[model samples]
Target: MPRPVRRFHPLLFVSACAVVLAACASERTLTPEQYEQRLPALEARAEANPSNAAALRDLGEAYAQTGAYRQAENVLQRAEAAAPDDPKTLYYLGVSKEGLEQPDAALTVFARYRDLPPRSRFQQLMAGRHGWLLRALLRDELAALVAAEDSLTAEGVTEAIAVFPLTYQGQDSLYRPLGRGLSEMLTVDLASVEGLRVVERLRLQTLLDELALTQNAAFDAETVPRLGRLLRSGRVVGGVLDVQNEQLRTDVALWDWPSEPLPGLSSRQAGLAELFALEKEIVFDLLVQLGIELAPAEREALARVPTRDLQAFLAYSRGLLEEDAGRFVEAAAFYSQAVRLDPGFAEAAQKNQEAQAMAEVAGGVDMALAAPRRSARPPGGTSLVHNRLTLLNQNLGAHVVPGDEAREPTADVPLDPLGAEPIPDPPPPPAGGN
Candidate 1:
């Protein structure tokens, strides 16, 4: 044996070591039942080593798996303190917040997680979480506003207005996209007014989706005041769009909750080819109806159109519809088309990136119901978003534990894992207990 040891090969030793590591790696993936079995030991380990972030994180994850969100949140918070920049700890903490129905807190934590360095591993996941929570918050706010309307008065932010999607009276689906596009244009132009506040188009869209407003379904007269209160706007604008013989006509009605008499309607008509000019005229007329004396500078800002190309605007409008419907993949495609049709269309470009980011993070997973990633560029190359997704998909088992990695999926593991399972809401914790 001593003589044979004289020719021991380092390459052979390396190969043997690799085989052992492979076996260990395979054993790390445990079934839900197996994870449950290890809870007692994990808890004991964490309790014995209060400062051990790894042990605390593991115990917290086990609690989360069992739907003990309060316990998980407490433990994960401690783990976060022990390891301040640990992405996995923060991720679990965010999930626990979600389970507790504290979407705002979850959003803050997820934002922190998304902003962490080396984002290539979990960027998509965090982006998806952002979109998901934002939409949920919008729905919740609308519900809360409606419930609290009895105590709410006509009093609201005096200069603020929410421009809702136009009710398209036109028969052609080809012109239906204008409902979203025209309102968005109005919102943009009106925002230039010095003293006036414009409610974001996203807020209006989400609320409309919540209201289940159909293409031709007009805004309910009864709900108008409530919508203004929810949007924190004293004034609300709803419009109707009609097209006939290549002539475009838009009529906007103003609802002022505070005033005894409602503002008069404003109407504009122009050729389809002069859509931008028509939109500008509508903006000026809206200002006049609101009794807002626009300064020269404000008029200049309002005159700037988003895009001159009608096709690009149409594509952008289609993207808006898809986005409002939560069909992020389709939205991204339409946005991209808009961007291509007119490269200077900044809004379309921005929307395209946002839609793509959301789609990437959602990855067609049931964790969130956005569409999957179909990269315009090949994912195998140096694309940052693609790389992030690739790393998450390919390196799930071997990633660093309890610090830089994501929460390991255990309970009813997803077919295409995004590395974390949904933690259902748990019962409230006992009084005076963590």
Candidate 2:
């Protein structure tokens, strides 16, 4: 369905300011336009360079200004799909939807826009749009909370839990990349503990794709039960990430299927720079809540950090998220960073090579990123952001090898598994290599 047209201001057309959009493009000079004859040229520009996200955005804006709200919504969405998470793209999407009177959908995009970090170059615009939209939806916010509370039930259930991708619910979008990255890292770390049947990342992606749930569903409360039931999980373990002062805090909850509550909630806090240890703490607490007895080997693994090099881990986590989002070219950049940061990081190196190859293929990708840029690094940092207002952080654990289709937990942790046995590290690939 398309959003309806609410109003059209003819004088505000593309001729006024062509807004030849690009990332961080506030200074990009726009072509002067008269609202009277600007639409065709903007459309031609977008058609000529289908991969030019800035041009697409400008075209969408032109449509909105002309009162073609439905067309504006469709075009703006395409811009968003290509640019993924660009605040300008999202802002236009929100504006188009707002013009069509779909405040609910508009608010979602506005939230994503506002949640972006300080350096996104659109912070001022995001803040203004976010404030107005938030005020517009104030009444709906309370209604949503009340509805969610009323839907809750305390029905007892099995111990199985599926940790959905962790999300950044804070006020800035800088940490958004860590949302899925943390989930994947948790899955890897939790896999170290015996008896827990962590859902593989691929299978969850498959399910989400099949169900046609948008990425937003991972952050939606209403989707938790359906997601758990589909995966046959007793609870879905995922939660909000927030940074306050120098502290990074995560609140994990197990949303039992059928809207029940379980004894599966825990929180972990650490200095923004000390997130590697926090990952292990979350795993331990999850195991304890699930009644799993960890063997000594498992205990040891939990105590150990996945990697001592923080920069490599950060690069890997950024790659992890880009990969999950199907932005292979973007992912390749981060993976390349990881490999460069730690030349010994074989898994990252391999993934980087693969992503670079895949991205360059004639797949349905925009030409901008399709051409491999091995030296590029996605938007993120090797060091922790010290801003008292925000931060983005994630640590890499073991690289996951592919597994069989995910299934329910059929058994408990047995004694003397990897946890009980002293797992020996392989001798550094036989000096020169294996």
Candidate 3:
């Protein structure tokens, strides 16, 4: 007021302009219905400015939200063609294709989005959804294929062999020992089948860890080769598990693993399952991969396995390993722990029964050997049960009661009748570090 200062009003004017621009940009007043209504406006905008990829994409999304799939697809495809390198345009194209029930094409579009650089949150969400949809469509298709094949087999047309190995990389890592154990069990189960060989691949844990250490792992060559090797099988089966927000999202693939010559099932992704259903599909796919048809009873058996508590399953695996080695005493202990951990574990229950029985037999043998023998000068006329017990003790390599006049056996006598060999220590840690 003193000097009527007109000093630097320009700075205030610039600040006000920036605030107005930000407000305009921040506005999200469009509802879903409003978004749908905006499609005609966006389409007109795109027609006026033919090079405006943003307008084209917005129109596509609006159309998609309104269930105009054909129009959405047309607009999204045009946007994708115009901005061939834009991840957003490609993502919309994928979304539109999914709405159109053209999942295979949608998978391609989503795959492109996955490969794009500077991935945004929106892109990640789309990719995750796309991955889920692809697996579901693939599994449905494979189920149909398997049913058709079963009908053919019923007609005595061709003997179809399905080999499903839960082939994955990183099996050797501590982080994924359960996966390795499951893979080993699958291999062992399939090994007993005639006319089928489970194609095994090296566990990925070591390689991935090594790459992590070296910091030179590129996705293109490394990941591509691993995936290609998996798909090389006539019928390849695989799954991917990702941790998002403390939950696991799994994607399983069961289709032709083409080598030099692509197989009939190469083009389509088939056989998908999610979460708990995913585990069932994995076991089921393995049966199909091995050409072992699942009857209703066998299907029920497969369905009985647990999924959520991987820790309990690992404990069960340890029990099975001990049981297989004939360490009944140790196996019983492990199985007991497994049962305590998971009361509902059916496989553990079965193994625990066998282990307990064997443990009882072992205990009886030890007790008989540890029992005190009667004095050398025994009273006359021992009962038949005593005699039988005495004989049983001797048969089990325990010291027999001797008469007063009897002399002890020479030190060179081999007293052990069971001829048990010394138990070797577990095999040394695997080479190149366990």
Candidate 4:
């Protein structure tokens, strides 16, 4: 008799493989001494052929590996100029940008790299890095992009803008709404301008998340340049809010999206009693500074305040801030508060419904971070599944949902010619079956 054969066990096999992979990841792949030794040869090759993009890119990677990000960036910039469309050059450039704590520039570089078509597996690796960047930069847009669609790819009608959260120099904690509230209101106002697209607030938070900024220190003059590059915004709006004698005074400033100031501040003072009108005033002034002229109807439309109740408006503002931070359930609660305070608050009601829907679609922010993005799959793969499901749902008809069946159209079968004309019984069965 043959000896009994041992059987394979899946649990043990999986455990062993996981242990090996974790060990590999935890271990250092390259020592500094090893990198230093390899750097000299690459530098010599790059110096010999200064215009050669491939040689320069390799040398730049070596520099970055050795923690010399300054040198890496300088060399990679030159390489990029030489090979404007090169994917590898773009990737290493992004790496150096990240090492230098310049996430905005890195994001911009990765965005360009993601659009390039790949020719090999290595090129696909570059595309994969782009996918990772997208998850970090545009969280809400991830699922849409994964579904083979991009909402941000539309051509520039005029210029893009990034609106930083408003700053409150006052010492009152209760006045916190002025910070996010005003900035969000400004974003809405500017977004209504025909030729301009305001960067979504969540995208700004994504940038802030990379910087690990506390809410208090997220935006300032020094950071605006990087923020602008990251959002690809040509203009940025920032403001300071202070209260004196029960009156609210706001100073709004426009920057050229990097560092330069546009012209002058757009200042407004309003009685706290009429605070609802201040947002519209600031919006109109900013529009003038950006050279956007709105028609009478458009201006009137933008002028409409969401709610007159200060507490309700503040709650809605808090909702926007929460939603931006990916706390949809909390945001919905905030919006619900606003709606309850002012039942006719249409904007707040709509936002409440939206937040609840998003909460259901995504359990939390972590899901959005790990959700499938467009670059994670082969082109058209996710979309194919989406399309097939859509077709299936449509074909099943409204009857599948327990609705009235009479509303849906029945299939149009061809006229039954055999039923109408019976061919005279097939000529008497061919004379008694021949």
TM per candidate:
0.66, 0.45, 0.34, 0.48
- Per-residue lDDT for 28-135 in model 3, tens only? 333457656565556666666556566666667667656687987888788767777565466556666766777788777766644654223234334444534544
Tens-digit lDDT track of model 1 for 4-54: 101123354344335534532443233446557777767767766789787
For every candidate in turn, the CA RMSD to the true structure comes to 16.1, 21.9, 36.2, 22.8
Task: Decide which is better by lDDT, 1 or 4.
Answer: 1
Q: Which tens-of-lDDT digit does each residue in 233-339 have in candidate 4?
A: 76878767876666788877877744464446677888765677887877888788778888999988988887887767776777787776766545655676667
Kindly give the stretch of ten consecutive residues in candidate 1 with the minimal lDDT sum: 400-409
Superior by lDDT: candidate 3 or candidate 4: 4
How would you order the candidates by TM-score, starting with the best? 1, 4, 2, 3
- Candidate 2 Cα errors over 4 Å, as ranges: 1-160, 209-221, 262-265, 344-347, 360-434
TM-score result, candidate 2: 0.45
Candidate 4: stretches off by over 4 Å: 1-158, 215-219, 258-264, 364-434
- Model 1 accuracy (lDDT, Cα): 0.63
Q: How well is each residue in 1-434 modelled by candidate 2, as lDDT tens digits?
A: 21221221223322211221222132222222343257776676667666766667767766765567688788878877787766556655776677687877876776674365433323323443454445335435434433455454434334455667776766645455556667777877776566667666756655665566655566455676655655555666777787666567988875555645444447788876677778778877777766788778868867876454555666677777666556654565566556655667766765654444333321211121111121122244210111100111111122221111101011122211111111112122223321
* Residue runs of model 3 more than 4 Å from their true location after superposition: 1-31, 151-181, 184-434
Off by more than 4 A, model 1: 1-89, 113-121, 148-151, 155-158, 213-223, 229-232, 260-264, 291-298, 360-434
Better of 2 and 4 by lDDT: 4
Please give the lDDT score for candidate 4: 0.58
RMSD of 3: 36.2
Candidate 4: residue 335 lDDT (0-100): 71
